[model samples]
Target: MEAALSLPATLVAKLIEDAERHGMSVDEYCRAILSESRAGDRSSAQAAVINEPSLDDLKLEQLSVERLSLTAVGRTFESGALSGHINRLLPLKIGCRVLWSLLSDEGVGPTIREFREEMWSRVGSLRDYLRMIDEDYARPRGDRLHASFPNSSDAAIKRFLNQYIIRKSGLNAEQSSGAMIDFGLIGISDTGRVQFTEVGRNFSLLSNPVLDEEDHRGPSLSADEQVLILSQIRTEMMREWKFMRHVLDGIHVGSNTPTSLLARINRRYGPGTKADWSASVMPHMRSGVLGRMQALGLVKRTFIENRVEYRVTPLALVILEADVV
Candidate 1:
């Protein structure tokens, strides 16, 4: 004999009523309820079992030493890439996007979703607006649009618009009318198509808080100052020229300091100490002197063997060369 089924008549009646309301049969409703109960139970059990990190935890992890080191180097290179010239001015928009992308990606490849979400958080929907701008004024390329300003990825463009343009302009008005009009960044034609005026392009490029001239102060050091600094650097390098060269040539092909390699130099050139060398050079090198060289792309640092190692950059070779030998 079949086992007796159990269910309250009132509950069955209520289920039937709900099923009728939704136009589902009693059998269908029961199946759905059972499936839903199982799903809910699974979800609750999973919630209890898994110990997922919160956004804050993720953020903290992102800020750890390993992440920070990569971020620092990536940011340095990103800035270098955008500016092209070491001392050239970068608009606020460009700067913000560059920084946000670097931080979000944590020095890895670009994340378009994170960038898009960042844009949506700041502005409504950047896609349609960007498309409109591209259709009206920009020339389309392979996967990007070229406007009067530099060509960049959509995420890059959106971040630039959000942090630099919208925030700086303080445009919080309705999407179609107030902000764009008040800021004079966009216009609607009689046919209702968005048209970019010359003034709009000029404002976007020059007036946008992100890419304005204020942040970029051109070259920080003059040619004469550069010459003086390079002279000092060369003088210091000459003291250990043969030693450094030998170290460079013989060093293991990886991120490593010259110490192990410099053993060769010590053997050939005698016992010279980095501490003594630094002490001697530190007096002649003023504060911000190394920073100036970095800005000029003359030197860079690498982390190897849990320590920082400095080396001359490619640009330094051109700048530091003697006439012949």
Candidate 2:
């Protein structure tokens, strides 16, 4: 039987909201937190390093019914049912310790006006956004930034937003969430005022500032875009490196078996490594680095001694010359 849980009205609302946002029922979201906590207990390897429960995991656990119902369920649940439930939900910690972490780096919150300004700095005149939505205007293929459009807009905007933004700067819709007040990024009060969250401030700062102070003479792309472009290139290279490393490691050790490689990769990077990391490394590698390298003709598949292997092409020699690790 379900108990009448005496949780703060606001906390209950937040739980329901978060559960919906994740596309899970409140019950499912709650259970997932418990499941994650239990899994953590079984893995000593991860616990050795990240002794504290990650902020993300803790927040999710805070939404769980078992946790929220702890104090005031009024004997509805069995005696030991909620006894250790709260302890299980709390992340592993030696003591209440704070560290020099990224969470602390998110400085003071921005005002609503500052939030709007930051968005405007990236998106520029809403002319493009409005034109797409109101007039059904489509930016030409050549004008597309990163070959995509803004996400907050309709098909026309979605198709063109990334293209326009990246050509001007390498920032894309997924990174910036277009120019809208994303509820995920910022918080909204019951009275309908925008609240600057830590994440919201970080996201706002990601966009290039309005005035290009350093580069007096504006170049082909703004400094922010150039930095972003370089970062993107590096990220692309790293992904390739990981894929290459996975394959090269196997090949050098005389084990190019796909199943064996997958097993090794999964052990190193699967579920316990980080929150929301893929359980199967194959899917990410397949469509990402492998697909890109194949399209670029940097590697080719070959059959050698009754085993399938990927050999680096002559064109990829330059890449191999560098220290892969």
Candidate 3:
């Protein structure tokens, strides 16, 4: 009966996110929440959804069809599938830079407390923003961890912390951004400071470059930095990510285009496997799977007549030949 209801997409996304957070399948999560709601207090049960919109609300501009661009967020219903909240948004070089910032100070870069307060603090005050701004402005312009906030107001800075940071890096709620941690690069120390693991230390050496506003390229990866960046695609992307090998296989088998590769993955996924999120996988593959591979020289990407295609690199072919799978 519940399956018949399309339900609010937002709620559906939240359900999957909560399920992933608890290391449960969507069905398992729903059952657990329902059992809890039935057995204990109804208010706190994770299953209890409130304030559904009415038909009139559906007609509102916010929920209108014209704003349907956000329907592609990855929804992981299966446990431990290719569904982690890695930085699907940022390119690998910027990610390296982010890691470098955390590895800057000796034994203490950005503390988890500071990250949590910046990313998700309800007690955020103007004084806090001003203090942070003063601290940041104290440093050289491009040398600040966060892009300097001298010109932006408190509210603007807060919004940037939530929206821009969330979109660019991802809400850490853990290590400033769960992206680095998921990629097996960074972790939190006993002192609650954001620190690099053995892998991240290697990544930091090259990522720390002189990036300044004089170079509007703050958001873009510069050529010199790209040359400086280490090749973690074969190591981390393929080693850590379960989805990369399959994407490599797809490219090798002539499923080179994004659309074709996506179709192949959805078609090949099985019931017992951990990858049942095919319904919401495109967003993850763009940069997360394909882009990283291309950036790290594992694949070649080209656009022809509005269609982008990828071809496996010689290095990637070597990995494919060596792979037993």
Better of 1 and 2 by lDDT: 1
TM-score of each: 0.23, 0.27, 0.47
Please report the candidate that would top lDDT against the real structure. 3
Q: Mind giving the per-residue lDDT tens digits that candidate 3 earns over 216-310?
A: 22322334433333234334444343466777888898998877887776765633345445465555644455644554456777778978788
TM-score of 2: 0.27
Model 1 Cα RMSD, Å? 19.9
Checking candidate 3 for backbone clashes, the offending pairs are none
Error (Å) of candidate 3 at residue 75 is 22
For residues 1-325, write the lDDT of model 2, one tens digit per residue: 9987798999889989999999999999999989998898878767755553122321222222221111100001111111111111000010000000112123222333343333333332333332333233343322222222133545544333322111112332222321122112234333322333333333233322112122212221333433332233334335434544555555345544556655665665557754224755344553343333432445455656877566565545554565456
Task: Please give the distance, in angstroms, between residue 270's alpha carbon in candidate 2 and its true position after superposition.
Answer: 1.7
Q: Give the TM-score of candidate 3.
A: 0.47
Candidate 2: lDDT of 59?
24
Most accurate candidate by TM-score: 3
- Name the better of 2 and 3 by TM-score: 3
Local distance difference test, each candidate: 0.36, 0.35, 0.47
- Candidate 1 lDDT over residue span 1-325, tens digit each: 9999889999889999999998999999889989999999999989865633112211212233232222211001111011111111122223233323334223332233343345444332223333444455432331121221223466656544442333222232223322223223333333332333333333222232112221112232334334433443344334323323333343323323435434443444442544332333332221122333443445455666777565676655564353222
